[model samples]
Target chain A: MSRSVKKDTLLKVAESLFYEHGFRGVGLKQIINEANVATMTLYNHFSSKENLIEEVLKQREERYWSYLDAHVEMESDSPFILAAEAHGRFLKEESYKGCMFLRAIEDYGEMDNNIEKIARGHKQKLLEYFQQLAHRKGKNNEKDLANQFTLLLEGTTSMTPLIGAEKATEYSIAMARTLVQHTS
Target chain B: MSRSVKKDTLLKVAESLFYEHGFRGVGLKQIINEANVATMTLYNHFSSKENLIEEVLKQREERYWSYLDAHVEMESDSPFILAAEAHGRFLKEESYKGCMFLRAIEDYGEMDNNIEKIARGHKQKLLEYFQQLAHRKGKNNEKDLANQFTLLLEGTTSMTPLIGAEKATEYSIAMARTLVQHTS
Candidate 1:
């Protein structure tokens, strides 16, 4: 396989492992073992494990943003519904492991700088997205709506395991109804 | 110092380190160095690193439950306010590093059994607390309300860094006013 092909393969496996485990928990050996790549091959695609870790998070950021874009299409009248649908769609994804961003932040205690930066950046975009949605929805001081709604989304994802509710997005739907502008 | 003193000292130092850096990031050596004790001192008090980890989580659970008790007493009127206030108090503590249960869960990728128990137990208690509060308030469905409010608390904590507002408790307060019953 081409290096790029192999690299992407490594990243996919790594993302699942890293997400399921965490940054520090999964090491080079495990990544290589899982990827079925030689140790040096793993190093060749990424300079170090840290870089590879960055790639995993970066991959998620791209996918997360893309998911947000495709699924959460908000028109002027339906920003709230857009946000709700976006969260709902996310919940329904085949492999749900709570919020990737929250998991990353919570897991890595002293993570590589690269991983931390990517996590922070992903979170910022979500916050900004919410802000825009609030503005689009004509919320007064939309920042309030944005911040509050962000908590609802974050809360639902983070609390899923604790509540043992298979479909957390349902709660997000109720919360979305509560948050949006109720103009019919 | 006595072994009890050494044990408490180790727990104190380790707790702060784990909170700031993460359980995996801070090794036994670091804890021993910071505690100014020998490796034997650590094992003498707690069976293993994992054991020590559980103890640290245990201490946090105590503080968390105590905090909940005081807040529930003060803001029993509204479930939302009570939940928010508890979280707010959590953020206000001297060594705030978001939720300890969350921190552990994040680090515990595959689960080592013991720590999982700690995380699971705390989460159950948290849900039960919410359920009882919701039941007392006579929400639509006590189970659903309890589950929903637990998500609120969890989600808000996860979003703390993204919001960048040091006083995240304020956001919880605003959310509480909306979600809780009108007791106060």
Candidate 2:
């Protein structure tokens, strides 16, 4: 395989293992063995385990944004409803683990400043994305609305694995509608 | 120390270490070392690391309920607000790691059936607690209201570690008030 393909394969395996078992639980050897790559290949692609985790987080964030963007392209609901449904759909379709970013912070927040920074930055960006959506909806007190929206989304993500994803999604969207209508 | 005192010390030290570092991240050796107890003492009291974790979760749940009960006794707010404020205060006063039960589920869900069961049971009980609070408040749709209340609380818990606990708590209570008023 080409070097790029090898790198992608490594990332795919690493992300899957890390998500299932967490950053600390899964090791570099397991990632390499799963990817069917040599130890040298893993080292060549990422400098350290921390670097690999950082790359995985960055890739995951991009994929999340893409999921939201794809939903916007297909749905014509109001921005608030559209965002909520998009997020809900993402939760249902994904494997329904808790938020990977938050998990990353939980694992590495104290030990690694860089990892925590990336995790916090990802969440902050999501909050800002909600702010933009609320702005597009022309809601009064858009910042406050965005914060509530973020909370609901975070709640939905956290609750999905325990409660079924479908129920969690339904309740989240229903609450989002109530919050939006009450504010309006 | 007395047997009970030794047990309490072990539980306290174990809880703190597990909260700061996850279950997999912190080892039994570290727990015993911190508690100044022997390995045999830990095993004698709890049988295994998993049992130790289960006891810690049970104690934490009791502490959480006591916090809410204390608040209800001291304040005259509606049940919904009382529960929300109590939870908010719990997050603020505690060191504010992510939800320990959910974290347990994440770490041990795949590997340990009993751990996952205990975690899920704890969450279900919290949901029921919310339902009782909603019923007391005479909400028209108490079940749905309770679900929303649980989501907001979960959201607040997840967000508290990222945003300051104060802001997360304030937003949660405000949103809880809106949810209660709307449902009523």
Candidate 3:
């Protein structure tokens, strides 16, 4: 494979494997073999497994935010509402596992600051997304509104596996709406 | 050491280490050494490392629910409210780590049904506790009420480290109160 194709292949294979079995569950050799790439090719593209993990997270994070952005504009609704809808859809897909960012933090947040920072930064950016949405709604208390919306969104992500995805999404969107519109 | 003392010591030490560095991060030998018990005694108490993990989780789950129960009755408040207060207090403690149940689920939920069941049961029982609280408050839609409260509680637990524990707990409790009273 060309260098770029090799890099993309490594990331795609690694992301799927990591999502299915978690970051800690898969090793570099597994990723290399699964990607069908040479060992040095893997090392040349991403210097270390940690570096690869971070890149995977960064790619996933960008995809998540971009998805939400598209849905937000298409729906012409609050980002909080749109994001929950997008997430619920994500959960329902066949390959859906739980949130990778939260999983990474759960697996390696304590031992590695870089991993923890990636997880925390993703969440922080999510909160900012909500803040911008609240601002667009012309709410004076946008910070509090953003906080409430973010909590509901976070709750839905965590609860979707336990409660069926459909019901969890419906309930969370209702709760988020109540928070945003102040209508019970 | 007496068998019971050895068992208790093993549990206490294992719980702390697991909380600090996830379930998969620690090993049987490390737990045994830290607990200062003979290898044979450790094996005698718990047949395998998985058994030890289940016991540690069970013990932590009991303490968590009991703590919420005590605070619930003492404050005559919603369990959602009281639990947030207790959890915030926990976060402020020097040894505070993320929620062990969620961490366990994140780590081993896919491959290990026993671990997954314990984590799921802990969450299910928490939802039941909220249902009971909502029933006590004379809510007709107890299930929905319980769902909302539990979501906020779960969100706060997950978000505490991202947003400061104090802020996360305060915001979650405010949302919970609104859900309880239907007052915006």
Candidate 4:
């Protein structure tokens, strides 16, 4: 089989298991079993379990960031609206367990250089997006405003599920708008 | 040993390991070893690993909520101000790994009924606190305000490290203050 085919299969198996059972709960044997591949085959595709895990994180990141870009465009969406839309998309996901970055941070334990870099990059992009919007609005401290917005965005994500209804996405929109309204 | 002393020792070990590592990362074996007790002794004191975990959650709950209550009673801390002080305490934690609930939730794969209950209970209290605060402030839709406030608190906790900043807490305090000011 080609590398792409093998890699795809591994990602599918790993992502499901990791998401369902958490990174620490699932093990190499289980992944191999679920993927229907021999240990050597699994290792052949990815150098080690950690690398395979990183690939899982990478796939989730790409899927999410691209989705965010599609949602928040320069041509449309006021800063508040754009930020709220991102939350909406996340809530729509059937697999929206929690923040992938949080799960990655939790599962990766001692963060590998690549995983940490990827996580940092994703967060930086979010901050940048919010900061750009604040700058567009002519906030005195765009950076500070952007950072505050990110906190509320994050705070909403966490609070929603715990808030105990399906209103997580909606709650985020309200909170995001409120936070943005303050700075603007 | 007295039941309270025995329980206290177990809670200490559980908190240290759970906070430093994670719930899944720390096993009963390790907890017992750290507590300096034989396996039977561990079983005798706590009904099972799950119960021990509850004790861990309970201890975390008490520590956090006691602080929350203290602020709530300060007479000067309007609902919003009390809420801000609570956020300040959360941010000032020495480790700042993440929210205790998120930490437990992340590792709590295949949720147990009792664990879920404890998690839900802790969240319920927080929301109630928020709601009561909003009510006291005469904020319209006090329930909604509480939901929004809870979301910000939770989101910031998880988002802090992802965004990789110490300012998350500061932003939380400032934003929380703004929320109270505007809502009040």
Candidate 5:
């Protein structure tokens, strides 16, 4: 395989493993073996496991937004419900591992600055998207409504694995509707 | 030292390490080394690392309730606000290690049934407390109010390390107030 194809294979395999088991749970050897790439090839592509993790995170961010983009059609409906519906659908997908950013924060927040930055950045960007939706909807206080909706979204994400994703998303969608009604 | 004292020391040391790193991040050897206890002594107290982890979680549950009890006087004010305030205070404390239960769920939710049970039980109990308080406050839809408040509380817990506990708590408290007023 070419260098770029090998690198993509590494990212794809490692991302699956990292999502299934946490960052600390999976090691470089496991990733290399699973990716079917030689150890030297792995090292040549990424300087270190940490660098590979950062790349995985960057790729995950792209994947997540891409997933959201496919589900959300901006021209069709209210941005608020459209965004909520998109997330609710995303939560139920077969490949839906829980929020990778939240997992990253939980796994590496205390130990790794770069991981924490990337994870926090993902959350901030999502919050900004919600703020944009809230503003477009013309809520009296867009920021406050955005904050509440974001909390509901975060709560649903954190609770899904325990309560099951569909139920959690249902509750979150209902709560979001209530908040939108109250504020709008 | 007495056997019980040795066991307590192991739990304390292990708990700290588990909280800083994750369940998979720390190992039995590290726990024994950090606690300065013999391998035999550690095994005598707990059959395996899994058992030790369960005990640590049980002890953590007790410690968390005790900490909350210290701050919340059921008769002094609205139990809802008081409990939320107690949690907000706990979140700001130096030893605040994110919700141990939440961390446990995130860590072992897939592989370990016992861990998921304990974590889910903790959340259920907190929700019941919120329900009882909502009943006391005479909300028309006490259960719904309780659920909303619980979501805010859970969201605050999950987001604290990223957003800073104080800000997270402030948002939760404000949202809780809004929910309470709406339902009352």
Candidate 6:
């Protein structure tokens, strides 16, 4: 296999493992073994475990944004509703283990500044996306609305593990609709 | 130290360590060393690390309830607003590492059934607490209201690390007030 293909394979295996069992719960050996790559190949691609995790998070964030962007392009609902449905669909179809970015912060926040920065940046970017959506919608107090919208989405993600994703999403979207109507 | 005092010390030290470093991050040796207790004493009281974590969660749940109850007893606001303020205060004053019970599930959910059960049960009970408050307030659709309220609180907790506890709390309470008024 080409080096890029091998690297992609390693990231795919590592992301799944980290999502199922947290970043700390799995190790480099397990990632390599699961990826069916030699130890040297793993090191050659990522340099270090921290570097590998950082790569996985970066890739995951890209996929998440692309996923949301796709939904935004096709949907006709108001922005908040569109965003809520998009996020809820991601939760249902993707992994229900919770937000991987937040999980990364939980796993490595105290120990690794780099991981925390990346994770926090991912969330900050999402917040900005919401702000932009609100602006396009021409809503008053767009920042507060975006913040509340983000909270509901975050709440949906956090509650997914306890309440099933379907119910969590339902409640979140319902509240999102309520908030939008009430604010308008 | 007396046997019971040693047990309390062990639980206290374990809880703090687990909150700061996560359950999987810290080990039994570190817990015992921090508590200034012998290894044998820890094993004798809790029988295992899992049991020790279980006890810590139980005690934490009790303390959390007592804190909320104290606020409930003293406050005169509407149920949702009062609950939001009380939960926000807990997030601000307590460790902002996020909800410890949810963190417990995140840390040990896949590996240990007992831990997951206790952690999930803690969340369920909180939901029911919201339900009861809504019912007492003579609200229609009490169940739905409670679920939304829980989501906002969970959102506040999840967002605390990113947004800071104060801002997260302020946003949560503001949204909660909007929700209550809108629903009423």
- Candidate with top TM-score is 6
Chain A superposition TM-score per model: 0.85, 0.92, 0.85, 0.83, 0.87, 0.92
lDDT minimum window of 10 residues, candidate 1 chain B = B175-184
Interface RMSD of each: 2.6, 1.1, 1.9, 2.1, 2.4, 1.2
True contacts kept of each: 0.57, 0.69, 0.44, 0.64, 0.33, 0.67
Which digits, one per residue and each the tens of the lDDT, describe model 2 over residues A1-184?
A: 4459999999899988888888888989999999999999999989999999999988888888887887764224467677777888878776577888888888787785677899999888888877777777676677787787888888988888877778888888888777778775
Where does model 2 exceed 4 Å of error? A1-3, A73-77, A138-140, B1-3, B73-77, B137-140
Model 5 over residues A1-184: C-alpha lDDT tens digits?
A: 3458889999999988887777887898999998999999999999888788889999978877876788666555456666777777766762344567777776677775788889889888987887777666666676666676776777776666656678777767776665555554
lDDT of 5 by residue, B97-170 (tens): 45677767666767757877887788788777777776766666766666666666677776676667787777
lDDT of each residue in B6-35, candidate 2, tens digit only: 899999999899888888889999998999
- Docking model 3 quality class: medium
Per-residue lDDT of candidate 4, residues A57-87 (tens digit):
8887788767677777664546567756775
- Give the better candidate number (4 or 5) by TM-score: 4
In terms of lDDT, the poorest run of 10 residues in model 2 chain B is B72-81
Write one digit per residue (lDDT tens) for candidate 6, span B44-98. Answer: 8987888898999999989888768877742254867777888888888885767
Worst 10 residues of 6 chain A by lDDT: A71-80
| RMSD of each candidate relative to the true structure | 3.1, 2.6, 3.2, 2.9, 3.7, 2.4
Candidate 6: regions farther than 4 A off: A1-3, A73-77, B1-3, B73-77
lDDT of 3 by residue, A39-129 (tens): 9999998978889989998988877766676667633656667778887776665224457887677667667568778987998877777
> What's the lDDT for residue B41 in model 1?
88
Q: How well is candidate 6 docked (DockQ)?
A: 0.71
Candidate-wise lDDT, in order: 0.71, 0.83, 0.75, 0.70, 0.74, 0.84
* Residues A1-184, model 1: lDDT tens digits: 3358888889999888876666667787888898889988888889987788778888877876676787666774666556666665655562344666655565553455666667777778877788887777666676777777777777766765564334566776675665452311
lDDT of 2 at B113: 66
- TM-score of predicted model 5? 0.81
Residue A89 miss distance in model 6 (angstroms): 1.2
Task: Name the lDDT of candidate 5.
Answer: 0.74
Backbone clash tally (model 4): 3
Winner on TM-score between 1 and 5 is 1
